[model samples]
Structures are given as structure tokens and as C-alpha cells.
Target: MSEPNVLRVEGLRVHYQTPAGPVKAVDGVSFAVRPGERFGLVGESGSGKSTIALSLLRMIKPPGRVEDGSVTLDGVELLELTDEEMRRVRLARISLVAQGAMNSLNPVKRIREQIALGLREHGAAREGRAFDTFLTELLERVGLRRGVGDMFPHELSGGMKQRVCIAMAISLEPQVIVADEPTSALDVVVQWQVIDTLRRVQSELGAAVIQIGHDMGLMAHSVERIGVMYAGKLVESAAVRDLFRAPLHPYTQLLIASLPSLDGKERLQGIAGSPPSLLNPPAGCPFHPRCPFVMDVCRTTMPPPREHRPGHFAACHLYETS
Candidate 1:
């Protein structure tokens, strides 16, 4: 029997309107998340990683809109839902630990109060000590002490603030957690701690997690499957071991090659050339400009996503072997 998927995104396109023109932040991206699966989305800055995350939760603010696509959670299409309806679904069903979430917390309110805000918004209890008890437990579960909940955001360290943010996101027992760069601001030790905590919470709660990170090394250990993104498109996706052992896309290979070795002396060589601006991306394959093995066809026509190996999919002219 196949595992049940908690979310499915199909042909998702997101664009941002700037003074100059429309920026195609996320163009025609598609993927899925199975229950209890830790799916990693890896890419450098400007690859639309965070844009995809925001679009998943319908949190794309003004100047940005999901121009096309269907984001289905369970059996429901979220893109069609109204703002009011989306609010109901945001935390109760599909929660998000967004980038800079520590800054999202209210400095004026106590941690307990901020968490309770989500509970109340999602129709969880707002009154009595019941909510307080739940908040305490969630804080402790995320590696914080119960008393930490009484402090304001300013009182906590950066890592502590992040823990509070995670606690709030999971307090509602959401079915899927979309964590965008969850460990971006932490030290090495704190990063591992947060990843471990996320893994532990995921196991105990049985919720699927979508982890978006640019660091291949961090993702190598945290996720079961990896999706590589380039210039707003999904370049390749495969199971964790397969992706590490034999990445099909040239971009994926280069990304993996850039990871720092345990020996700590070899100079890590990252990919050259900056990512293309979404406002006016390359004509053919979005990655064609940067792909070392780029062929003539890659410069004229976009490649459709195809199964390069069993369960491994890639979008590149190189894999269009008829």
C-alpha cells in the first residue's frame, strides 16, 4: 500500500509585481508530501524557496499572488478558499514556521499569550488555564522550560525565540508543517538541536514536514526526499540516498559537490553565476544558463519533467532521451 499524501501542489505559479514589472518568483512548480515524510526543498537564494512556502499557506502578501496552480491539502483545494476560510486552515491543518519567525513574535505580548492567539484564532479554547497548560507543554517539548512562556520575545535568546515560534506553530497539532529555513539564524549546535526537535515532534505527532533550506549538508540529514529548485522551477527530485549518491540533474550534482567535507581542509566550490531574475528569466530552461552540460535544445525549449530513474524525476533537456 502506498503512503497517504498530506499535501499536493500542481503547476503552482507565483508572481510578484514590482515597480519594474512582474517577477515570476515561483513558476510552474509541483510536488507532494506524504504523511510523516520529511521532504526537503534545496536551492540558493532567489530560487523561490520561501515564495513557495508562503504560497503553500496562502500567505503571499500584496504585490505577490499565486497566479496559477492548485494547492490541495487533504482533498480540499486551498487556492480557491477565501481569506476567512484560509485563516481557519492556516494553523489548524497546515501550519507554517516561516523565515524570521522569531521576529514575527510580538514583543509586547508574553509567549503564552502569543501562542494562545493561534489557538483562539483556530477555534481552540481561549479561556481558562487549559490553554496555558497546553502552551507550557508545547514550550517544554520544543526544549524550553515552562517559565519561558511568561517572558516577552525580547527576553529570550534568538534560539529560544525560534523554539517559541515552533511551539506556537505545533500547538494546534497541524497535519503538515511548512518550515522555511527553520535553522537559518542558529549556531551549529542549535541548528542540530532544532532539527532533532523537529524530527522528534514529527515522529510523535505523525505530521508531514516540508523543510526548505539552501544548505545541502543540513538537508542531507534532516529529510527523507530532496527537491532541488532552480530559477523558480523544480529541477530534480529523488529519494535522499539516491539524490546524494547519483543526482540526475547537473545542478543537483554541482550543489552536492559544494558541500563541505568532514576533513575541513578541502575548498568547497559552489556553483558559479548568480540565479536569474524572475522578472525576466532565461528563455528556455530556467537553469540552462548555469547548467554545465547545457545542450542546444536546452537553450531553445523548456524540458518537461520526466522520470529519469525509478522514483527519481528531473526537468532538463539532458534527460529527454527518447
Candidate 2:
């Protein structure tokens, strides 16, 4: 959907303080998510994809902190909000379906109580028959039976637990849902089911979704647009089909090339080297060491992002301004 942006992140930067120095988790990453759109952030481990998700919800802890930038949701500045104000923003405006359902769910609490926690925090708590009907409709939307809510986490299967989390995330009808690897550790069939459930609820609510995952295959078909992150920066941004068909960044190209083709004819290609350490990244482009088309300029000069095609942007020495 080419609707107005529901969320906008500009010049975002997050760092983790360490004995050696700061680990630049997110460095000047910027993008916008439109209403009813599914946006994916794909990257290798430690590439700051989840960090960006947490930053959006103001969840950075003690050792880690947001150093700069702004996060605006529907024209309201999130970073400027007070703690109490931010609490209200969460669940009500932007909710998260954590990567691990076991970790997010309370073993002692019934599913209804856990979900009710969000509603209560957002001051939308319901009780008795009212809550039962709401819970039934919510769980049904995620393809679960209403009685599943009265059961404890231990009674549910892995897939059901995840579906419960999805129910919790959408229960408040948030404007944006941050799903960080929602389908992780699930079987293929269940993965598809969970994704379908998520897509259905998102469409029903017309809420934007930020899908963070390392599974390029799932992301290829799930999201409308994708942002490729490398060395704590977004190296490329484009529509899903455009990015996969014609990845501009060297890292992104290598990533796409590494995917196994369904025909089983194309040999999987791998990147030559590993990603650079953010603690002391290379002087110029972090990817120049692994880039096949590295130039003299790439060794000492960081390439500024440039738009190479309509609605596609990349940071690489290969692309010159038109």
C-alpha cells in the first residue's frame, strides 16, 4: 500500500557501551513504514535489525542507549515522550510479537491474563462476558479456539503459543506491529500458518508491520519492501521484488545470490569474507573488504546513499548520481 507513512525513523543511532569502546548497533538508519504495509529488515546476526525494533519501542536498556535520531509515529515524536507517556504509546499504538513465545509468555499466568495485561496497561481492560467475547474474537482471528485463552502456556504447542502472541499483539489494535522473527523455530507448515494469521490480522486492522528476520526466503514473499542492513547500517532499501531482482549493494547482491533456487540448477554463492566488527570498523565502507567491485575510492571514502532507481536507494561506490 502506498499510503502515508505511519512510522518514520530518521538518523537513528544506537550504541552499546563496552570496555573496549562503543559497539555501534544502529548507525544512522532511516526509513518509513506506510499504513497496511509489511516492511522487512534483513541482515546477518548482530547487524542491528532487532536493535532497531527495540529502539522503536524505546526498550534500550542500561548498557545500550539510543545516541541520536528521531522516531515519529503518526506525527507524534516517540523519543520525546515521557516514560508514562511512552508506556501508553506501547501496546496501544505499537505492539511487539517477540521472537520467542516461551520467553514472552508467563508460565504461571493463563493466556487470558497475559493478554489482559496489555489491555489493562493501555486502560482498555474488560471483564467477565465482555472480556470472554473479546478474547474469543481475538483468538479466533489468529486461528485459535476461544477456550485456548483459559489455558496456561504449558498446555499449548509451540505453534499455538506463537499464535497466542500474535493475538496479544493485535488485541489492542495497535497502529504498528513489530514482529521480530515471529515464525522462528517452527515447522514449515506452521510457519506459513503463523505468517498467514499475522497477515490477515494486519489487513483487518490496516496496521503497518515491521517484520525483522534473517530468513530471506520468507521475507521475499511476506513483505512489500525491504531494508538490507549490514555493519549496523542500512545499505539498501527497495520494494521486495525490485530488491531481490536487482540488489544494488554488494552485500545485498551476495545475500540474494546465496539463496537456494527452487529449480536446484543455480549453485548457491557465498560472500568471500565475514562482516566487519562494528567496534572498530574499516576506515571507509565496512563492506569494501568483501565487495567484489571494490575501488580505490572505497578504501578511504565512505559512499553516501544514492537513489539508483525509482524508489530504490543504495550506498555503494558503483552508483553515481544522475
Q: Write the per-residue lDDT of candidate 1 for residues 129-151, one digit (tens) a residue.
A: 77667777798789899999789
| Tens-digit lDDT string for candidate 2 (1-322) | 4437999999999999999999999988999999889999998898999999999999989699999999999999999999999999898899998768546689999999998887987999999899989999999999999889889999998889999999888888999999999998999998998999999999999999999999999999789999999989899999999998989998898888888888858766889888899999887888999989999888998888878899999999888653
Once fitted onto the true fold, the runs of candidate 1 whose alpha carbons sit more than 4 angstroms away are 1-3
Q: Whole-model lDDT, candidate 2? A: 0.91
List of clashing residue pairs for candidate 2 = none
Point out the worst 10-residue segment of candidate 2 by lDDT: 96-105
Clashes of 2: 0
Give all TM-scores, in the order shown.
0.95, 0.97
For each candidate, the alpha-carbon lDDT, in order, equals 0.89, 0.91
lDDT, residue 197, model 1: 87
